[model samples]
Target chain A: MKVLVWAEHEQGALKDATLSAVTAAAGLGAVDVLVAGDSAGSVGAQAAQIAGVEKVLVAGDAAYAHGLPENVAPLVVALMAGYDAFVAPATTTGKNIAPRVAALLDVAQISEILSVEGPKTFTRPIYAGNAIATVESSDAKLVITVRGTAFAKAAREGGSAAVETVAGTGEAGLSSFVGAEIAQSERPELTSAKVIVSGGRALKDSETFAATILPLADKLKAAVGASRAAVDAGYVSNDHQVGQTGKIVAPEVYIAVGISGAIQHLAGMKDSKTIIAINKDEDAPIFQIADIGLVADLYSAVPDLVARV
Target chain B: MKILVPVKRVLDYNVKPRVKADGSGVDLANVKMSINPFDEIAVEEAVRLKEKGIASEVVVVSIGGAKSSETLRSALAMGADRAIHVLSESEVEPLAVAKILKGVAGEEAPDLVILGKQAIDDDSNQVGQMLAALIGRPQGTFASKVEVEGDAVLVTREVDGGLETVKLALPAVVTTDLRLNEPRYASLPNIMKAKSKPLSTKAPADYGVDTAARLTVLKVVEPAVRQAGVKVPDVEALVEKLKELGVA
Candidate 1:
């Protein structure tokens, strides 16, 4: 089976999430990475270095600059010939584009698959990770989006696959890019971060939340996350939310402070290798899954822990 | 300009679902159900637009069993002008659901269509983009902020890194993300009035769409459980444990 993996990138640099997707794609069959963006030749070159990639397809056109679903979905469909499956990282961009491609192809898209049981069968979490469903697609062509945290990142530089330029379908004339406000942060991205320091509503307000969590995060060089309650309480922006409805992260070390460990929050971070929960309430559900539990007031414990660490 | 919002009936968010003993699927026999939280947000957004006079009318639609009308009624109580129920007993996949919604859009001709990014049950965040594709229209998905300006709608989407704003011409599709708006509960008077609201019913065949399952579920199982670990007595012990683990 031949599979086409959409290589997600930003500012012409390949994203690590794409490497995880390439690894997932490799399990299915021969992998071809598609890097589509204006002046993204370097991105294609970077994709070619991923181990096990058979080829790197590049579509450098002005219309593909913003990675809009209108432009990218049709492009993927146009190139779907001779490929049995199309895989993409289940990032925001992939979630936005993959279903359109599936609809255009008249097939059901298997989303956020955790494991590839077979060429046409996979397992994915349903009900926000409360259950896992193993589904087999009957469509002639498979469309899939892989959870980046499930698969290990493919080796970055071992292969020397050749790159080829593909024609792009310019401007679907449907949507226009306005502006973007991307958060600039020195810490690692939450999904890909090795260590995460997450706060909950018990942080009280925005100022206390930041003052208490930021120092710990900075010391560990970890990404910061917030519970839904914390975000709803206006302690942080929605982008920092980690839950079933928010970003799912599986870091090496996860530290939850003042979080009551709601089921929704556990859906996002339970996959972390090691979990540490510090809450004043000993019965807070977060302690149920935490490898290391501390029943103390986070106001003082977090600061003490940060200074000690 | 009219707005069409698609709501879904899903297991209530607060309920923790249980896998069946036979490993067939989730046990929903007696589970309480509610409108998907995100779609409720979509309906709220549409109603707010109508209140702002940006939308002349707000219509809500759902494709499911007869019980879905109750979900539509909830939307109506929240302030939708009318409702449409595409009756189907069996599960409809996202692709087929998009086809049905496309047919509905063809008939309704709404200026904007808003949907939840995904259902809490299936967690398949597909229909909005798929509907946009089937209808050949622009899509602004995972929207946190939506505004109608002249002939176009400016949607601020919650993307991976931060937020992105896009301009889509009229008759576009949008999917709601969190932080869009706090949905208001149905008032007692509004609930009473919603029973009399116009709710039209249609069939999938009426739209010339085939509601067939393309994917077969082999089995459903619970995820691996994480075992609770030992509790550390104090901050010093926690730091010492982290140091032992080589993660500090």
Candidate 2:
């Protein structure tokens, strides 16, 4: 099978998530990488160096500079003729673009695939990760998005494939980009961070969330995360949410503060190497997976832990 | 302008699904069901648009079994003008749902379509985009804020680490995220009134679409379990343990 993998990048450097996607596509068959952006040439050179990539395809166009799905979807559709499968990392850009490509091709798309049983078979979590379903697709052209945490990143060196240029379909002109407000944080991204400290609704409000959770997170240099309840309660922004509906993180250490451990929140972090729970309720479901359960009030425990650390 | 909102009934977000003994699928015999949380937000957004006079009508639609009428009624109670239930017993994937919705959109000629970014049951997050692509309209997914002008709608979407604003032409699709709005509870009087409102049901075949399973589920299994290790009496002990592991 000839599989085309979208090489997701930012600032001309490949994202760590795409390495996992490359690993997923390489499992199926021969792999080709497509770099679509204004600086595709620089990115293409980097993509061509990833091990097991057969060839690199570059579409250097300003319309794709921000990777607006409206522009990227048509480019994928135009290049879908010779490939049997198309894959992307299940990131914001990939999630936005792959579905449109699948729809234009009139095929069903598989999202957040956890395992590749075969070229047509995959394992993915449904019902908020309560049940894992293995499914076999019958579509002629398989469009898939691989969950980054489920697979190991492919090696970044030891291969040099030829890079080829591809033309972008002119802009659809249906939607125009107005502006973006990106959070500038010195800490690592939540998805790739080695340690994460998450807060829950028990924190009460935004002030407490920052006052309690931020100190411990800063002491450990860990990424800050929040349960959906906290995000819904306006304790933090949506980007900080860690749950089935939010970003999934499998860090080395996951600390839950004031969280009751809803199943949806656990689904995103249960795979962490070590888990710790600090909540007022002893029966909070978070204790079920915590390696260290501290039964106490977070208001007191969190500040103490922050000082001790 | 008429606005359409697609809603789906799923196992309530609070309920943790359990796999059956035979590994067939989740046991839903006695599980509590409600409108998907995101879909509720979608319905709420539509109702707000109607209230603001930006939309002349708000129609809610669902595709499912007989129980789906209950879901549609709830939408009507929340302020939808009427309801359309596309009755189907088989498992309707995203593609089939989009096709059926396309048929309904052609008949309704809605200027705007609002839907949940994803259904919690399958979590596919594909229908809205698929419908937009099939109808040759633009989409603004994961919308946190929306503003309508004469010919276009400006949507502020929640992206990875930030927010992005886009202006899509009218006759577009917008998928709601959690921050869009807080859904209103259906008052007793409104629930009573919803039952008398018009509700039209049709089979999937009426839309000239096959709501068949394009994929077969080979197995259903529980995720790997994590065991609770030990408890710490004080914060000092926790710090000591973390230091021992070199994590702190």
Candidate 3:
């Protein structure tokens, strides 16, 4: 069985998550990494170097820069027959394109799969991570999206790959991108960050959050995140939200401050290796999963924790 | 403009899901079923659009067994103008569901179509894009906010890197993400009002749509259960335990 791993990139560089996905695609069978985009050439070269990858397919076009279904769906569908299984990082790009390809090919998709079972089955979290479900696809071809961070990223460099360009007129849609406004930050994205410091409604306001949470994040060299309650309360932007309805993130160390740890919030961060909670409420659900729990106000505990680190 | 919201029925998030002994699928013998959480958000958004005078009517649709109409009621109670039930005797794969929805689009000609990002049951997350493809319409998926402006709809999507704002022409499809909006509960008054709302039923034959499963579900199993970590006495004990395990 041949597997195709879809690599997503921005500007001129491949996203590290895609590399993690390639590492995961290793479990299926002989991998043929497929990189789609105008600047996909750079990403394709990286895929060929991955140890398990037999070859790499590069579909490059200037029009493919920003991932839109109009372009990616047809290209993936056209390439679907060449492989037995397809794997992609469960990023927005993967989530958007993989299913379209699966639909076109008339197959079911296993998304955000945490583990593969033998050859044709997978284990994925469902019901907002409250429970995990196992799916077995008896189809000839299997398509899956993996949680990129769960796998070890393979680093095999110094090689090249054959290029294959897919001709597609982008989808006729109601919307077009005028521009993008990225957060002006140096820290890694919250989803990809190994150590994350997240604040909840307990932060009180954005000013307190900046003064308390920011310094602590800086001290830990961790990414900053917020709870859904914080975003809803206007204490943080929606970008910082971490919850079932927001973003599902699993980090090495998840330090939640003033977060009561609602079931939805826990659904997002419960998979972290180490959980530390700082809250005045001893009964807060965050403490149930915390490796370190300080029953003190975040206003008092945060600055001191930063100093200690 | 007429709006179409595609809702999915799944195991309620609050309840624990049990796999069937035979592994056919989730054990739904007596489990509580509800509309997929994200679909509720989609339904809420469509109903809100109508209430805000953005859409002329909100149409709720579902592609599943006869029981799926219960989930459709969720949209009706939330303020959808009417409902369309596409009952399939067997499980319909995502691709086929999209094809069915595409046929509905041809008949209904809705200006906008909305659905949950992924169904908790299958977790395939493909129906919206597939439907968009079959209908030959642009897609703005995982959208947090959608507003109509002129002949286009401005969509704010949750991309992996950051928020992306895309403006698509009218007659596009958008899928709701978790952050889209908080789904409103149906008050007792609204629940009563929903009974009077129209729910039209149709078979796949009526729309000339196929709901066959190209990929068969051989079985479903419980995830490999893991041992929850034992709690240490305190922070100092935790550090000691970490050191005992390996490096402190």
Chain B TM (all candidates): 0.98, 0.97, 0.93
Ranking by lDDT: 1, 2, 3
- For residue A184, model 1's alpha carbon misses the true position, in angstroms, by 0.6
**Which numbered prediction scores highest in DockQ against the true structure?**
1
After TM-score superposition, the amount by which residue B70's alpha carbon in candidate 2 deviates from its true location, in angstroms, is 1.2
Q: Candidate 3's residue-wise lDDT over A1-309, tens digit each?
A: 788888877777777777778777878877777777777877777667766667888877655667777667777777776889888888888888887777677677777888877787777766566556666776778888888656777776644545555565554444467566657688777877878989988888889888889997886678899998888887767778887656678787787889998877887788787777777888887787787677776786677666555
Q: Rank the candidates by TM-score, best first.
A: 1, 2, 3
State the lDDT of candidate 2 residue by residue for B35-134, as single tens digits: 9999999999999999998899999999998999999999999999999999987779999999999999999999999999999999888899889988
Off by over 4 Å in 3: A156-175, B18-31, B183-190, B208-248
Q: How far off is each candidate at the interface, as Cα RMSD in Å? A: 0.7, 1.2, 3.5
Which window of 10 residues has the lowest lDDT sum in candidate 2 chain A?
A: A180-189
DockQ of each: 0.90, 0.78, 0.44
What's the iRMSD of model 2?
1.2
Of 2 and 3, the candidate ranking higher by DockQ: 2
The Cα local distance difference test for each model comes to 0.94, 0.91, 0.78
Higher-scoring candidate on lDDT, 1 or 3: 1
What pairs collide in candidate 2? none
lDDT of 1 by residue, B1-248 (tens): 99999999999998989999999999999999999999999999999999998999999999999999999999999999999999999999999999999999999999999989999999999999999999999999999999999999999999888889999988899999878999999999999999999999999999999998999999999999999999999999999998987867
Give the top-scoring candidate (lDDT): 1
Q: Could you give candidate 1's per-residue lDDT for residues A32-135 as a string of tens digits?
A: 99999997799999999999999999999988888899989999999998688999999999999999999999889999999999989999999999999999
